[model samples]
Target: MALYQQVTGLEPHPKSDGDFTGLNREDGLVIGFQRVDGYPAPRWPDHRSPTASHLLQGQRGPGGSRGRLLELGAGKPDHQPHELARARVLTDPAGHPFCIVRG
Candidate 1:
């Protein structure tokens, strides 16, 4: 929750006592949030943008994974050279798309 607040600058999301849970993947953590409108949304880093990839690559030390790749957006055109291969792709509880790639 602290991480989410820091990253998104949002308040701590309230949780339900229902049988809800979270997933820990090799890429990153997937957090589930249920909305009052009866929908589930997930929070992840904004690694989908091409510019974000470049910044990440720069932060990573030398001799890391290097190569140009395409990042397929939700339905937009694929962004190229997103140096976020080391990042993990995490899906929401409802199978929504999210990613947590960092250098």
Candidate 2:
């Protein structure tokens, strides 16, 4: 959650319950996080689990500006598919795929 906050600059919304944590953006985009017991890690650009979340118009990263997600603990896959030229595929510390579309 801290990683996301640093990357997007959107603070988490007030928690209704400890089980769920979420962040609400001014544009009405709300990202929610919940714990599911024994939930398997998702496969990127695949059938089982896809880009569960996507941040539209993400800036094209370069150097220190190249999305601090990696420094913040995001994972980068070894290979990216051709379909995702404009979107960068990355995983959180938990291995959930997120796409950052070039703005």
Candidate 3:
């Protein structure tokens, strides 16, 4: 049993091209290597919202930008971490890392 197995409860194939979006459908995500430099792209379990989430679900005007990126784990100032004591250390879902790139 590997990490994906432990987390997703499925035996995902190694080296097989997979769409994690199917693992959690309503989340609307896609995983890929973006051709950008200087930033570290996330590996397994890193959340990626599909481009359609912004193009179809969000509002974009003639001069507006494309896509929306959000970290699911965020806290309001009034709310503090009830689980971890650090209070501000944003941990990735499933402990995966992520990076943003600009073109």
lDDT of each: 0.33, 0.67, 0.27
Candidate 2: regions farther than 4 A off: 26-29, 49-57, 60-67
For all candidates, the clash counts are 1, 0, 0
| Deviating ranges (above 4 Å) for candidate 3 | 13-80, 84-103
TM-scores vs. true structure, each candidate: 0.24, 0.72, 0.21
Candidate whose lDDT is highest: 2
The ten-residue window of minimal lDDT in model 2 covers 57-66
Regarding lDDT, does 2 or 3 come out ahead?
Answer: 2
Clashing pairs in 1: 27-88
Relative to the true structure, candidate 1 reaches a TM of: 0.24
Residues 1-103 of candidate 3: C-alpha lDDT, one tens digit per residue: 1322232333333334332222222344322222234435333233462222111111132211212222233112222234343122221333333222222
TM-score, candidate number 2: 0.72
Q: What is the C-alpha RMSD of each candidate to the true structure, in Å?
A: 11.6, 3.5, 14.6
> How well does candidate 1 match the true structure, expressed as C-alpha RMSD?
11.6
Clashing pairs in 3: none
